[model samples]
Target chain A: MKAEAFLQCSQCKKILFSVEFEQLLRVCPHCGHHHRLLAKQRITATFDPESFEELDKEISSLDPLEFPDYEEKLEAAQAKNGATDSVISGWAKLDGMKVSAAVADFSFMGGSMGSVAGEKITRTLERAADAHCPAIIFCASGGARMQEGLLSLMQMAKTTAAVQRCRENGVPYISVFTDPTMAGVLASYASIADIILAEPGALIGFAGARVSKQAGVSKAPSDFQTAEWVLQNGMIDKIVHRREMRTTLTNLVKMLSWRLVKHG
Target chain B: MAKTWKEWERPLIEVEENIEKLKQKAKASPEAEREDLLKRVAEFERRRDNYIEVMYSRLGPWEKVLVARADQRPYTLDYINSIFTNFTELEGDRRFGADHAIIGGPAYLDGEPVMVIGHQKGRNITERQYRNFAMAKPEGYRKAIRLMEMADRFGLPLISFVDTPAADPSVESESRGISEAIAASMLKMFELEVPSVSIVIGEGGSGGAIGIACASSVLMLEHAIYSVIPPEGCAAILWRMPDKGAQAATALKLTAAWAKEFGLIDEIVAEPKGGAHRDAIEAAGLAKEAIVRHLKLLKKKSGSKLKQERYEKFRKMGRFLSENPVDALAKTR
Candidate 1:
């Protein structure tokens, strides 16, 4: 019997065997850091046991830009990931606190943000607000979906406004930064979270660190743009291990629950 | 038996050497010149201390500018990490590819759960490449929108760190659609149903920075610069010369102090004695305290109330008392 193969680290160029990587949940054994997982797996891990109620799972994108072979590319990605669009939105529980979540699947066209992703995120936030539940988003993307043209970029403002409405409704919003969060996503709601978190060794920034090097800036220190660096810079609230996320979130929800009960 | 040179005839070096010799001789022959040498050394020490104190205390604005731009300055990420713990990163927009500009994740502050986001610059070449010099691209903004929406669903407060020159403007970026991404981010941030706070940790430039900066309360580091355009870009556009960046900086009111004075920023986090760079740990500590304090106050409100206040804050950004510039110019004509 042939063993399954695993993906390699895009940075250190280390190839991880399938079994070993899977045991670690795709996290690198050598690095002891988490790696990007499929959107489905992310949802499974983040939500309470058997608590995910998916929404808008059928929404997909069209080739509005008419870019050559764009449809074929989308089709290929969908076939590979078995998803209609790059984003998946749903209702779930984090530590028994009802919440809504939307995750972008990076395997689909490099996880670029497009019209569909924007709509899904907006709808998710709206649902969370309506339900009076907190919202949690797992962002993994390349940037604006180029095939969508200006429509993709417009999602920044549209989603930002959607979240604004959520804020007005007294809902809690949390953003989780992973490796390679950048560009338009950084400019928009990613940087506007009330509490932000990052994983160790994850590359995080708006511009590529190389751009600064090209601009004649000094070299980055070891760990620069890593989760530790962000934490030091006061951009994130904490650096929780992946395994501890559910428990940490539960504690937070419990506190919020107490406050709500007392006030309401 | 040696013939002694008079003090006026001796060179300064010779005089110092002779004084040292005399001091030695005083121990054996009771010489009178020893006291004078000690007095001169004491006077030099006093003068050196005075000069150093005076120079440091009277630094010029230009010099302060240099200090402000120092790369070693402690920023938002440092402070947030220190105060908050147990962070988990979530990556990618799942559409194009991963961008290394913007960072967001889940973390805990003072044992409270929250979500965080920020624009991070690099401390070195490799890191700068990873961070794209903190200039976000379309994906970065989109990712932020995704995160905010999640925060709303989870009832987690949001904290944003603004520190970027601007959005990327490469041909590839334009081809990829930059403006729409920014617009979407602005719209989503305005609608998020969580208490949000923004801190300008370094350079908050243009819509790229503002897209994620729509918060209930916005704060800035003392030396951080927040402006619609970088001084150099402003100079190139207004004066047709990049060398006039200093003038542009002054005119733009980009500094934290200026923004505070203009009511564009809610507060200014203080830096260390020489600047944040000189004492990053201390600087981060101070910023963390401020963030915690703000977050605590915000947690008191319901998600809906937080959203309302956040919307009102953005709505009031440019609502100062002033006549229309076009009308004033017409009247002058």
Candidate 2:
């Protein structure tokens, strides 16, 4: 018998052809659980074809404190992810709408916000604010990078300040929370937005489940930090499925940019 | 009063204890022995000072963390009682419930009207429970937001004291949108037109600290430590072992000196040799001096200018500049 490449869904454990699963955007057809996407895959999913023009491609971290094994890890992540940092952002056309989009990749150091990643996120907001374009961000992070210490912590303030400027410029800011958005990033820019959306089953909260459990603050049920729980908590506006994400965003862009979006 | 001492501070504590013991004996002994006891007491005092100077100057990163979280450390209420007058605390988020983890309201700082906010670590068990060990929930931050808005409306200079392990990490906190509350608090600080200063009196842990610590001038006391995560948390994540907290503390560079050198903080207010916990009166005085100085300097600027400067202050923080300011935001290819 000929060998066939197959994959098991992470959530549903259903076997399927690998190529078909990739074509379906890695979402399980049976259960509709959206798997985590890489930055490249996310860009392809969100932006128009050939519309992604990279920004700050040359910017990378300097290992400021000379933290042990950090430089090596950065190098390894760079080599594997083909990016300088955890976040990849730029001016792009999202569902035919002009926008500045920044996406965090959990593959790189758990998508932690170090100085470089922060600078990229800041520039994304700054650019959006200055251009009066909508800022759309896909946030996936383990909060601030411990390797960068206080510098990483300061990014929360920096990004929040950027968000302030973006809001003052009178443009909408949209945030999409992905899997495991917790701690510093959650406590800052990820939570404040014009419209907040999340993928199905994403673990989104300010503090970690284990940490909260250990701290004796949360005697939560099994579905505590899930997107449904976040929705129930009134933190997010909507939960969009993977296949319908582009359509939902298109409708939003059409409504928001009705005045500015040049009609053909 | 009973005191807790770290392992590294054993020798200094021993000498100090001896000074206390001999001083007791010197007060009641016969003339001859009293004189000798007095001389020995003086010698011990001198040695104690010497030990303090040397040991404190050479405090390891872990020791600083320990000191920053010392049981006797001056809590927010202590500083408020010592530094401000006619203080009236405004509590409750109004939207939900009250959180004693954070407390603030309009107060008289040096006889001038100013809004003061701080993380209140409890002095006793009851207070600690009341304060949630200074770990703020969403409502705590929301309360801060309300007070800050009032400060802007009333044209009061805002002063915030940062002292927290982190924001409360719990089911209830998350359910109430703790993340959004904190982010809103930070954004509110940036939006404030009034001159402001934030002083890190102790542990400025993670985003919880920065939620209110964004100001025109961010100051930290000499021994206070601020970081993205607590040392123990960092050790567990980075080294895969919680016992490697000492090593993680060293690597994190969370000291006030590091913050100053990195330009993340404006100044490092000097603490006494034994840290601010030893003499909270002096600590509050030093904090008052720094606050008055920064507020005076900031008050000269127009409200709009203060807001702009505050935005730039945080915007300019960090070691990463992939390109120059203009080029980084320049056109992307």
Candidate 3:
């Protein structure tokens, strides 16, 4: 990388050498803000080398609503992100231990859950429940995909019902909240996990802050929806840092899977 | 009494006002002209009814949204009063405070005991404030979970009416973990051993709607609108143009017709001509019939079988193309 190339920390607004920033996995050295990672970056950061096996890679959405410009939008998102949809679904090993995994990337259409994204998430959990393996999902969504409309709304039920499969089978399901997990996704599989973890400083809530104001609720403090603030309020189990996220997931899944085996 | 309606309803209103004028003219005419005037009144009345039937059946997606949100539309409490007997109103989630947005309790369905629950929108401004305009907080969803669990325990058939613009999106709701509260409600409805029926009686908004709507049979009224977000919200977020709500509504395919066509809902309960608001009694009667019919079919299955069937119903919903096999991944380059 060129030494002259620089990146600014979005949170702290401090100039940093791009190579140094990349070395920290895009975590700001000045303010410790963890930059949102692409889905592929999250996959590589968390999973064991060569152990991730993608699932439902060919699954993509259909414009059943014949939504104007939707097809073109989908094409652009695909080309921009080098992926087919907002979510990257598959199974990967955490520190050599297998778990069903699905990582949502915000770069792809704001990580909205449309039919394909919902189908993939549901399939991942179903696979985990069927195989008696632990499942983990990294959630980073704005909400349901408004483009897909009611079909997207139904995914709330579809995915939550999939989570029930895990509950009934006594399988462990974990969800990690990345930056900006809210609305439909948070209200579904993301919140139903056996253990809920969030990255430090991630925005995790059911609704956005602007909506709070629109609804005439008292204005919230700046730290209102932050993971640390929510941790104090008891919405999630832990606020793990980016560097510690893998180890935390590995530890939690190991114990949760062990409990399942003992129950058997 | 006079009724209020949006601009989209002008066609029906014109026909209705004409019928009213013709009836008045018949009363004022002399006996010889009275007979002919009465006949014209009768003819106009028929035309008005027909107009309502056709217009409602052919309403655009955005027009459906307007009707669903119309102040005159019959709400859950109205349906409860008209359809059920021996009604009781329960309150509070017991974990947090009570949310007035959702009202529920054990009620007599015909002569049998059953649980009835729904999002209760306000009929007046003051009441709307108390009801939070039908938007639910974590407490409301929690209260619903309690009602659902009780219904399951008692082996009573559970009925839910979904109506809202989505869950309460506020700091208090977030502080109380509104997301998990709603998710728990969905999980509870999905796993219940007793037969359950959910009707989208009005505006079936996003997570708030789906939370209590995962039932054995999911139905939507003919005029109700269900979507991931309200048309306004969708437009503002997706297009950055708030005035494009009608366009968003069309693109969203939020109408009951679309829901039924996509097989997302079990059936479309017919509202009285115009809407459920126009003829509450007749609309409630039709809803009662649909409920009774579904209960008869659902009541025959054993508990575990019914539960499993409910689970599988939601498990199969989606529209996407899967060109590769699930297990062919690891070996593929």
User: Which is the leading candidate under TM-score?
Assistant: 2
Question: Which scores higher on lDDT, 2 or 3?
Answer: 3
In the range B76-136, model 2's lDDT, one tens digit per residue, is 8899999999889999789999899999999998789999999999877998899998999
Per-residue CA lDDT of candidate 3, range A117-141, in tens? 9889998999999988899999999
Candidate 2 docking classification: medium
Report the Cα lDDT for residue B331, model 1: 23
Writing each residue's lDDT as its tens digit, candidate 2 over A10-60 gives 888999887888889988888888888999899898789989888877777
Interface DockQ per candidate: 0.05, 0.75, 0.75
Candidate 2 segments whose C-alpha is farther than 4 A from its true place: A1-4, A259-264, B1-8, B321-333
Task: Give the worst 10-residue stretch by lDDT in candidate 2 chain A.
Answer: A255-264
Give the local distance difference test score of model 3: 0.87
Query: Which structure is stronger by TM-score: 1 or 3?
Result: 3
In order of TM-score, best first, we have: 2, 3, 1
Specify the poorest-scoring 10-residue window by lDDT in model 3 chain B.
B324-333
Order candidates by DockQ, high to low.
3, 2, 1
